[model samples]
Target: MKSSTLSTLLVAKAIFEKTKSLVNSGDKYSCTAGIILLQDFVELVVLAVLDELDAGDQKSLESKSFDELLGELKKLKVPVVKSGTIKALNKQRVISKHYGQLSEPASIINYFSTAIVFTDALLEHVIGSKLQEIFLTDILKDSPSKDFLKEAIDVAGNGGYLQALALLRKAFFLSYEREYCIYSFRQQESSNGFFGLLGMLGGGRKAYPWTRNKAWIEANVKAPADYIQVDHEKLKTDCMEWGVSTVDVENFRRLTPKVVETEKGVWHLDYDTNFAANELSLENFNYCLDVVLDFLLKKQAFDDGHKWPKRVKSGPTPMIYIDKPIFERPSTTSAIVEYVKEDYYYTVDRVVSGFDVNEEFLYAHLYPKDKEFSLTLEDHIWGYLLAE
Candidate 1:
């Protein structure tokens, strides 16, 4: 088809998708808006068909009313199977938009299904394809998540919705798993008690038992550096923490077949006969699909560096996992420098480079103004350094 015609069809498909979502909302205003958009979607589909037939015809058809456009399609020998339903949708839209009337919530689902049937019939007649041919997954950013969703779409088309849900669950699981590689410096303090005795026994100060223990902790325990990884098993908790609705997630989980993880952490669908016997309808599949898509879209924005509003903490700033390092300097009254007791200092610039979070996260969660401190360093650069 012509590029212009193709673009119009895509837009019409998008409008239909939006209509589906809005009608499902069951709100008075949203249902009314859905009616209006659905009518526009039908008109646009008719316009696209005319454009594909002839550009001049499309220009002429654009000036005609939606009813006239549908009638013109009949004159041109194009399919008009659902013209009655399309006209009814237009009437509802007119009452809602011009008369300020709201569609009955009970009728919204019927209207939604009618639009679906009409669009499918129209698209099939004109382009030898159904409305489902338009893949919303195409609009997602190119990533493994998109690839998985595409696979899910293909399997869903073949009526393997259980398998499709498994793929979608995996996609969501991988998308929101946050892992950060953190590096830290250990606090060097004077040896005391048992450790102090060991220090004196180990060549009295030459071996430096405190430093030796520190090295041991850094080497054997791997304390100086580690990874902070969120648990994938806590899917619902993680979703809530990421700002997704618990209700939506619970609904999706209820509709989709159970996804279980093996001891090896490999995930797969459990095809128990009981679950397999449960009737999974297209509407159920669509609900789960929409939930996953909504989550991924929001996650994509966050991955693109969009900041979410900071949430308030209930109490004092929590201590981070990083170890504190002791800073020793010369004392005015003592012959030897004294070790300054403090938490490990963390510069925002330095920590941001190592952590997956941003400066906003540090300022809000880890190092709020009340918890922040400043200290002079050998480099003479002034920057707020935080501690755990």
Candidate 2:
């Protein structure tokens, strides 16, 4: 990342981490920096990531706060969009994960619409996997980031964008990306470390590629961020005690966003129309087999052909309820079948229980691993949500 691209004021992630410790433990300056630390991290990550995408794009990253960053990311070419993903938008994760505040219903909805799409793009480049195996939707279950995305989609797609944005304001007065960032990833666990230097990358390559190729050059990513965080003694002490485990000092990994296959009549299972996806046939597997006679009944779809949409139980207690299949592929993975959800994410490695989404997406981390923060499955779904 370029030094000229990021803001010095926003560059204090390490100091901010220290400030969070003080604030959490009742330090006077804690409250002031605590709330503001979120904004600082969001602002810096935006400036930093933008510079990484295109070095010359620094001016664009510097001038715009949150809105421009989304615009820049959205405008990326199809090549980058298809092969890449944009994570860390959850930079605003602090409010819920740190402050324990709930994001308003509407804010959660609107923010996610744009976010899911961006995350999808970034994941492709960074993880190099198909959408199905990426484990992104897995992360959404209890995650504030995932919740925000789903709620925003449900409200806006189900309601309207303006109303959703209004709800979004409850968390961020700006209701822009920066405010959202404050809610997601603002807390700094260390006074000095690689994450801090990433803060120092000041919008250069050091940070840019973090989103797409994070598995590639992570060792080099830490020094600057760590150096600065180490300078703050009190902040370091506070973080260690607050349940912000040492691993929290670096970054977290998450699943990529995906669009299910919805190609309207494009794909048809070799089963009977009596128990088809669009018909919502509540036929049991055996019943479906009976009517479909001699068919393999491998998959189903939506009227518009949304590949494996969520299966929500519809109608009354006595009604024959058919759910939208979470996945539209053969139960066994060894066979060569094109598990075509809307755009075709990677094939499932192993199905999670009987649920379609339980499968892991194909992800290969090319960047070097950072010693500071290593990602855990819990970070994505938060252990409790896994049960449901």
Candidate 3:
């Protein structure tokens, strides 16, 4: 592919992703912006395809309006399915942008669905690429959340909707529930760091140190926003706060299983009737994923260049000092899974139950070997620890 065409396709895909995030919002303004973005995506994708297929006509097409572009695509013998849907999307965009009209929040989803269907068909027919195959995860910062989202996509593609939803839920928690370094500054007894730099810039004046009372320091120094209490209720609140419609949240939660964070900052599954794995539909999975992408995208807007604190871990302690758990084990790893739900000190003895299976099996699933933060072996026993 030509570099210009490839670049245009990437930008178009990004716009498409942003549309998904925006249209999912409950806010009318966001929904209107989403409509405008969807129109831009359609135009860019068509432009990219035209540029690739017939570079000679690219300039003329670039000056064409949305309807004119469609007409030109048809004139070029390109297959343009769902023309009416595209037209309606353009009409909405025109009304919102040029005419200063607001789109109804409820109506945005119809446009989003139509656009996805049209884009999927267009891209597949023109370039053998499916719209679903394009992902926004590539543009996100490298984190475990991104990894989980990628894995969720793979799982969903393979018809593992439940597993995919679980992964997506994990991705949401990892993205939003973690601690961040906020602006923190206060007068200190010693001149150091920012104060020291300020002193050097004071025209040769020496740094002045001020000792303040504990109350003054406490009032002035900002603490890090750490370890959010995440649950199904918080997820709903977050979704609404991020502009996701209450209806969308309800739809998303209907398919998603329950998960709650413990006092120790570890998320544990709280299965209920909603854990109906067999009831998970592909359409619901897609919607849930879309809503989550919106949440993550919103966070990404402000999360750039911010330092997040790692999960806390316990120092090495003897296994013999820990108390053994007593629980019914339906499966080999069930007891260990239950044991690791809480914040336990370092020791396999704490998780060791009367019905405990081999430590290897327990460690492999509940706590993977590759995760450094999950590993807390003390006195030759696998121990539970918070993951980073």
lDDT of 1 by residue, 175-221 (tens): 54222111111222344544444433322232223343445335543
Per-prediction TM-score, please?
0.53, 0.21, 0.47
What is residue 196's positional error in candidate 1, in angstroms?
Answer: 30
Off by over 4 Å in 1: 1-18, 25-30, 48-59, 72-81, 121-133, 177-250, 258-265, 270-279, 301-388
Candidate with more favorable, higher TM-score: 2 or 3: 3
**Highest-scoring model, lDDT:** 3
lDDT of each: 0.58, 0.31, 0.60
Give the Å shift of residue 313 in candidate 3: 30
Those runs of model 3 whose alpha carbons end farther than 4 Å from true positions after fitting are: 1-37, 52-54, 71-79, 91-108, 124-133, 136-147, 173-228, 231-255, 259-268, 275-279, 294-388
Order the candidates by TM-score, highest first.
1, 3, 2
Clashing pairs in 1: 187-325, 324-344
- The order by descending lDDT is 3, 1, 2
Question: Could you tell me which 10 consecutive residues in candidate 2 have the lowest summed lDDT?
Answer: 252-261
Of 1 and 3, the candidate ahead on lDDT is 3
Name the lDDT value of residue 109 in candidate 1.
76
